[model samples]
Target chain A: MADLLQTPLYDFHVEKGAKLVPFAGYEMPVQYPLGVMNEHKHCRAKAGLFDVSHMGQVLLTPKSGNIEDACLALETLVPMDICALKPGRQRYAFFTNDNGGILDDLMVANRGDHLFLVVNAACKDADIAHMKNKISDTCEITVVDDRALVALQGPDAETVLSALIPAVADYKFMDVAIVDYDGMELWISRSGYTGEDGYEISVPADNASVFVSKLSENELVEPIGLGARDSLRLEGGLCLYGNDIDETTTPVEAALTWAIQKARRTGGDREGGFPGAEEVLAQFENGAPRKRAGLLPEGRAPMRAGTKLFSSENSSDEIGEITSGGFGPSVNGPVSMGYLSTEYSAEGTKVFAELRGKRLPAIVTKMPFVAANFKR
Target chain B: MKYTEEHEWLKPEGDVVIVGITQHAADALGELVFVELPEVGTEVEKGEEIVVIESVKAASDITAPLDGEITEVNQDIVDTPTLVNEDPTAAAWFFKMKLKDASEMDGLMDEDAYKALID
Candidate 1:
């Protein structure tokens, strides 16, 4: 096994009573003394700070100094409308293979002169390699290794963050800003995976500790770990890369068609040019065979990941399996998300999950099991 | 009271023994959100999986520590699982069972041995 790497806030996490665990090649705090349940509730009620520096941050610059060239070049890899993305705005995107399966889901921001992207930690190396192998001839791909990424999530995130970087208050959801603080450049974005309104900030490595420390002085901000992070995102109905959607799961099957802008669809301005355009665009018009659905277990026992799903109580045929399942502290019950056959994927349909040799009833429901609080 | 390597505690009271997880096990599992206990009056052998516990992070199972027939199961932990975190060895006792062979209790670890194992 390779030695696990520590983030810039490693010492800070230890001092704050974090339970460090190995995750995606990094020694990340899985939870603090505050525990996962309270940390999840705290993020919904107030604010929670999460260390996400292990994720890959990359910059793509066009050699011709033209942003349009870079956007068009990137459009060939992802199915989103990169050409229409305005400056200082970020959009969700994913790379697809020839089979229409997702390679990785990422956030791409138009940073005026260059395009900035944040990819998943486990898929970072492969994503960067794919980019370099495909578009390096037209654009310069630079791996950003000198910054620490942190997310301040919850209802109080705006008020708490604006006090430190005053300009953050003006940025709405999905808007990005470059701010100068203490002789360092901080990249801030008003977006997060947790349904709450918040910001994901990229701070220079040298000043990460002090920057996070200053934010923690606020009573509303608590240091959350990977445990709460998973639960919060699960409750928000957002997809975790490997768990919810993987190499075999397509954007249409994953219920991520919303991320695919209309311009990339069958009858749009720039259509059918991405990697799996033929298969993906077809799924958009004629629905996919199976799709992701939200599951609310009737009982308290959580139907964890990999639990098999059946159409009826006594059916022996397996229809699908749960991707993510856990206790939603905000909803005060067990909430889950999984893929099901299109016929069984309706909001009010009944499905049975097999647990401990017994089939338990679950209802297919519309998700964001907790309502989203993003600032428009 | 006797301890199992799996971190369960057994307290003898006449022919029936009260079974619960130790504080060390509770701390390791974090906050318990749900617990599924076996039915009372069911006969079980040692090491049979009988209890299912779900914390906020993951799900785990607790097995039978010794061969016995379940006499009573704790409904408090099932209704409110966090009680196991607050008072694991006492108020959060999972089930009471009458041992088939009481001599099996002698093979379990004492407090000093359990403490040394955790240390």
Candidate 2:
């Protein structure tokens, strides 16, 4: 705890009565005075501000000064169609290992001249090193340390953001732009993990507090913390890197194949080039043995992570294990996601989770327990 | 009324005592989502886990404060768990038990001692 780092908005979070907890070597707010339940609901209805500065932000500049060179260089590492990514858009991607297991899930944005990436906090250092060791010859990797990233998410996010920066009104989901605000360049991305219409803004570290303060002033915006952030993403059916998907889990098994564009698939222009391309492409052609599925417990009791799932109430054979589970405030019940045997992965299938020595009944349901509201 | 270091409160009514958590414990646990109480006829020893509580953040257990036989259980809190957060000491009373030894209450903390412990 003594060596834990603080983000740019540390003092601001303290001022707002945040319950700070250690996360990925950083002292982050687990929840504010609003608590996790209400904070989660607020993010779905109105707007909630989140401090995401703990995540890693890196820029990739091409050595040949051609953005296509950097994109082609990145293709050697990830399986995404980075070369076809437009200038003002971001795509979800992951760094796959030689075994097809995901190193970390990340966002890759083509910022015109350079590629901007945001990786998970715990894997930031390793992700940067992996890129440098692999693609440094073709592209110069620069870690952006002097910026603070924050997410403003929910139904009212557009109304709240457009008021501050009028140009944001023209942007839709996954759109990225560098806009001027009070002579400062703010990198804004119309994307978030909450399955809501929102924006992830990167402000200079020195002005981070001021920008957050301005957002907090809005009647619709309340400062949210990590607790609510986790619940919101859980309800949105989004994966938490270390929880749902990890070094041992591949994108196909995690049910994230939708993020892999057609150009990177089998028989496409850039097929079988990235790490683990053999296994990943094979899984695409023939389904993976195990697949991630959503779980809706019949009772109010949450069947949390590490809970073993059986095919039936009295069965000793384990079929799966819960990866993420908790009370979903919006759904008013326990919602969860986990890897299940391909046989039990279909929606509406009945499964049993062992909790406290009792086997609880649950149904395999479609995810996004709460429907997404992104402005497409 | 007596309190335990585990944040439970006991109000003696004749040979039976009503059990529930304190407001401080409720606040610390945040919003409650589920409660699992013991069977009414079950006999529980002191320090034995008897009840399970789940909040949005995580799940926790409530142990038997003293050796006793559960005489009754609160089904309301089991249905609507948020009652524990709204009125932990009153309406959210988890159960009532007949003590195996009434003298066990003598060693518990008083209101002031419990306040000092929480503070």
Candidate 3:
């Protein structure tokens, strides 16, 4: 346990009655004294602050005036359209290995001056090394390890933030801005993991604690932990890095094709350049062998990752595996998401999930298993 | 006749020894979101795990109160987890078993003794 890292707010969380547990090699709060269901529902209804300081933040700039050339160089690595990203907007991207498996998924925000990236905590070190090797002297990549990240998420996030930092409300969804709240400056992004209107603020490590404490001053804001974050993201049909996605699952198979730009799908202009481009392109044209599907479980028996998925029509022959699942507090029932064969991937299609020794009835459904209320 | 350090409580009735988690154990677990029950007729040793209880954060195993063969198991506790948080000493019994370790029961703690053990 000594090997696991702690965030800047680690001690603060312990003081606030947070039950810290190990996750992704970090000692994070699984829930507070209030509990998981309450924390989850609170974020959907009001505002909740999450200490995401464990995520990696990096800064990158073009070698010359050739930012597009630099973006293309990186675009050769991920399938996302880096060249098409507008200033102040962020896009999702995935890293693929040689066999079309996903390495990790992250958000790359065009923070006007350069680019601000938020990658998974578990993969950050390796991801940084990979970026350093692929990117040359033509581009500069710097790890902003000195910064601490906090997310204020929910429907009233903007209202609460605008009261403290007036200019924050001006940005639209997926847009980012750098602003001054009181005397300290923050790089604020109108984005978050919970399917609600929210803001992710990046502040200097020294000020993160005080700044987060200041936000918690509001009666509406509570400090949320990783447990609620996991269930909340899962209820929103979002994937966990090691569970839902890994070095063995491809972006196309995971139903993340929406992240890939249309032009990039055909490998237009610059072709066959990225890792697994050949295999990824073929799956893009021919359709993938398996696809991610949301499961609405028949009863309250919560299915978890690695549980076998089957179809009763075929005598319970295994068809897939549940990658992430739990009782969705807002939905007031059990929900799950995982990959399934193409023959059983259609939304509304009937399937069965093996729970304990019995086969529980399940049906394919559209994602965000919980409806999203993000501010457009 | 007794309990384990894990706070599983047992009371023998003829051949069957009724089992449930202790109030001390339930208080620490908090909110009792999920409970995993053992099947009927399963033989359990004196120190073996027989049932599982999960709060939101972690999972804990309830060891066999005494070596026994499960005769009856509770389905109501599985349906309503909060019973463990509410009436842990009564309606929250995990199962009823034929005590195979009746001679070993003297080693287990009583309610007052269990409370003192925590202190």
Candidate 4:
């Protein structure tokens, strides 16, 4: 624990009575006194401020002083069409290994002069190292370590943000803009992991605490913790990096084909030059053997991670295992995601999860269990 | 009243002893959404898992503190699991059991001893 790092808002979290736990090499707040359930509901109804500063932020600048060159270099690493990404727009993308396995999922924003990236906290070091080893000569990778990211999310997020910066109201989903907040420049993005209308603000570490305090001062805004953050994203059908999507999982198998733009796929100008393009494109044409699907347990009992899944007809035959599962506060029942054999991945397919030595009935349901309210 | 390291509490009320999780356990478990208690008349051994509690985050098992036959179970908690978080010590007792051997209570910690262990 001595090696655990502290975020800029560590003191504020402690003052608010957060239960700190070791996460991604940092002592992060898992939950507050309001409890996970209450905090989850509060976020859906109003707004919840989350300390996401643990996520990695990096800037990529081209050595040739051309943004297109930097975008093309990035295209070699991921399957997304980086050149198609317009300035002040963000897109969801992931790094792929040679075998087509997902290295990490991230957000890529084309910021006119340079590309801004936000990677998962746990995989930031590896992702940065991979990029540097692969493309450092063509594009300079600068890790932005002096910033703290906070997300204000919910149905009322726009209203609350408008009160602070009236210009934010003009921004739509996936929009990114640099705004001046009280003499400090903050990178504001209309994007978040939670499937709600929200904003992720990247602020200077020195100004993070004050900015968070000011945002939380609103009556509708409450400071959320990692516990609720996990449940919220789970209900929203978003994949957790290490759990749902990992080194062994590919973007196609994880049902994230939407993130891969048409320009990079087959029948396009740049048809499949990224890593694992051959395997990925083949999977696209022939289909994957297994697929990630949502699971809805029949009863209130939760089927957690590592729980083995069996065909409803036979208890002895194991077909898959739960990757991420918990009681979804919004769905009011146990929700889970796992890789099932392609035949069993269809919606409403009956399945069984082994829990406490008993085989409980479950159904393959469409995620998210709760509908996303993104301002698309 | 006595407590176990597993956080189950026992109160002697004549022939049958009442059982419930401690307040500390409830707080740590957070707001319980569901509870599955052992059926009445079921015999359970000490250290055997007899109750299952589910929160929004995860599910946990509550073990039996002593060898006993469950004489009664609180149906109120089965209907409203939040009672476990609201008043775990009193109204939300899980079950009442007829002890197979009352001497097992001696191995349990008293209130003050349990407080020290948790603190």
TM-score of chain A of each: 0.99, 0.99, 0.96, 0.99
Task: Please tell me which predicted candidate would have the highest DockQ against the true structure.
Answer: 2
**In candidate 1, what are the lDDT values of residues B13-116, reduced to their tens digit?**
88899999999999999999999999999999899999999999889989999999999999999999999999998899999999999999999999999999
Query: C-alpha displacement of A109 in model 4, angstroms?
Result: 0.4
Whichever of 1 and 4 has more lDDT, that candidate is 1
> Residues A1-376, candidate 3, lDDT per residue (tens digit)?
8999888888779889998888778898888987787898999899989999999998777778566766776786687788888888988887778888888888888765577788999999988888888876656888998888999999889888988888887888888878877788899888889888899999988888888888988989988988889888988888889999998998889998888887676747555567898898898889998998899887666777787988784475788989988777788777889989999999998888876567878888899978887777
TM-score for each candidate, following the candidate numbering: 0.99, 0.99, 0.90, 0.98
| Candidate 4 chain A lowest-lDDT run of ten | A312-321
lDDT of 4 by residue, A1-376 (tens): 7999999999989999999999999999999999999999999999999999999999999999999999999999999999999999999999999889999999999999899999999999999999999989889999999999999999999999889999998898999999998977899999887788999999999998998888988999988999999999999999999999988998889999999999999997899998899999999999998999999999988888899999974568788989999888888878899999889899999999988878899999999889998887
In order, the Cα lDDT scores of the candidates are 0.94, 0.94, 0.83, 0.92
Between candidates 2 and 3, name the one with more favorable lDDT: 2
Rank by lDDT, descending? 2, 1, 4, 3
lDDT of 3 by residue, B64-107 (tens): 76677889988888898878888998988889988775777788
Q: Please write out the lDDT profile of model 4 over residues B27-114, one tens digit for every residue.
A: 9888887888898899999889899998876789988888889999999997888888999999999999999999889989999999
Q: Calculate DockQ per candidate and list them.
A: 0.89, 0.90, 0.33, 0.77
Local accuracy of candidate 1 as per-residue lDDT tens digits, A102-160: 99999999999899999999999999999999999889999999999999999999899
Displacement of residue A353 (Cα, Å) in model 2 is 0.4
Which residue segments of model 1 deviate by more than 4 Å? none
